[model samples]
Target: MSHAFDLALCALILGAAVLAVTGRNVFGAIVFYVVYGVLLALAWLILGAVDVALAEAAIGAGVTGVLLIGAWQGLADAGGLEDEAPRPVFLRLAAVAGAGALGGLIALAVISLPGGDGLTLAVVDNQDRLELGNPVNAVLLGFRAYDTLLETLVLTAALAAVWSLTRTRVWGGVPGPGHVTRPDGVMASFGRLLPPAGLLVAVYLVWVGADAPGGAFQAGTVLAAVWILIVLSGLQDEPRLNSLPLRLMIIAGPAVFLGAGLAGAAAGAVMGYPDGHAKSVILVIEYALTLSIAATLALLIAGPARRAP
Candidate 1:
């Protein structure tokens, strides 16, 4: 049964991918892409990668779908949603050949790879040192802390790049378009009711991440989604990039992580936790990261500054 289910899912995923790529309308393509992400998340779950599933569902499906929808809406508003010139038949054929070749190469690579425990045993053996119940969390926040730190920095840098695209007159201004909502609308009601529940879920995910599949990235995505809903429903206005509190929230994660690394250096190695305090230090970093990541992702989806500060 499981094998049959897996085969069916693979078929669905392939169909969704094809539709996402070839759909005539941008909106339809975005919707199909979201379906592809959701199916991909399910595939990850079936492969016993719950952490990857969570990240896929949150970032790939949820956040990316919202971002694409926003972009499509913007294009529509600007009268840029009209169909573009079609590619020449030869160019289209070349693209198909290139895509097929790439797919074949990927399949070959996967087939040639040796399958083994591959880091699981090593991570389990060293998990005690990090005091994290979740081996994935231990690897992310402990053994591979530098990589995670770099990823956070990359997200911040991406936000900086987005801000750089702002007009000179609107530099350091508010991010995202102004939203006005009818007070009695479903969106307004959802904006009022959902955030409180979302906040609890976000906090719980971050707190439980030390021992489970949940983590900073998934929790941060949820938090960002809630904020986006609030802004979109007109429950709150987008914050100016120059706002002191907003700026602090955006940098809190990286700043704290860097500080922890420096403090770790004083203990003999960078990003090293002091003996008997690994969990405590990691939790602190996770909380800070959750805040920063949430803010950064929300702003990224919101796009560059528009209104004046």
Candidate 2:
């Protein structure tokens, strides 16, 4: 029964992947990609890696799905879709050959490989001294915080790039609020309910990450949703470069993470994300990252909010 289920899941994944890559409609492709991700998550659960499964689902299906849909929406009205030509037959054949060759090489390498990935295993072996309940989160915050810090930079840069390409900030190209509505009416009431509710989910994910299946990135993404909702509803001005608080949060995570790494040398370690202060370092980094992500996302949706004339 389990084998049959796995086979079924694999078939579904393959179908989704094919449709995602081959669909003529960009939106359909994005939707298929999200479906592929969900199936991949189920596969991971069957493989006994719940945490990894969660990350894949959250980042792949949830975050990336949102990003792609927004991008498609922005591009939909541009009329460029009408201009694209189908690939030449030779070109399509060459692409298929190249992909098959690459897959074959990968399989060959796996068959010949004789060793295992070791860094995490080493961390787990010495985790008693690490004081981290979640070995994976500990490694992220303690041993590889530099990578996380740099990743946040990449996200910021990507947002900026998207802003540049679209000629506006928001990927979905949503127009600024059309008209002001009652602040005390239905929309405002819904907004009030979401803040606390979303914050609770975010905090729970962060705190439980120490021992369970959640962590900083997941929590940050969840928190960003709240900011996005408020911005979308036009209850607040789409915050712009004028917002000092938002600016600070935008840059704080990398500053704190880099500072901690440089400071670690004084204690004895010469690298960032050292073992001695992993949890504290991770918590601080996570909080900064969360703020930065939320602010960036909100600003992206707000696009450019010009000064009032």
Using lDDT as the measure, which candidate wins?
1
Off by over 4 Å in 2: 101-120, 163-191, 272-277, 297-309
As for model 1, its CA RMSD to the true structure in angstroms is 1.8
Clashing pairs for model 1 are: none
lDDT of 2 by residue, 1-309 (tens): 988998999999999999997887888899999999999999988997777787788777877888778667657667756655678889989988999999999999877876786465788886655567887776677667667667878877866664555433343343344435578777777876798899999888878887777787777777777876665555764554535666678778767767777887777774444566666666776777767776665555544443331
Q: Which ten residues in a row have the lowest lDDT in candidate 1?
A: 80-89
Give the per-residue lDDT digits (tens) of candidate 1, residues 203-295.
999999999999899999999999999998998999988889998999999999999999999989998999899999999999999999999
User: What shift in Å separates residue 302 of candidate 1 from its native position after superposition?
Assistant: 1.4
Q: Deviation in angstroms for 293 in model 1?
A: 0.8
Cα distance off (Å), candidate 1, residue 9: 0.2
TM-score of 2: 0.83
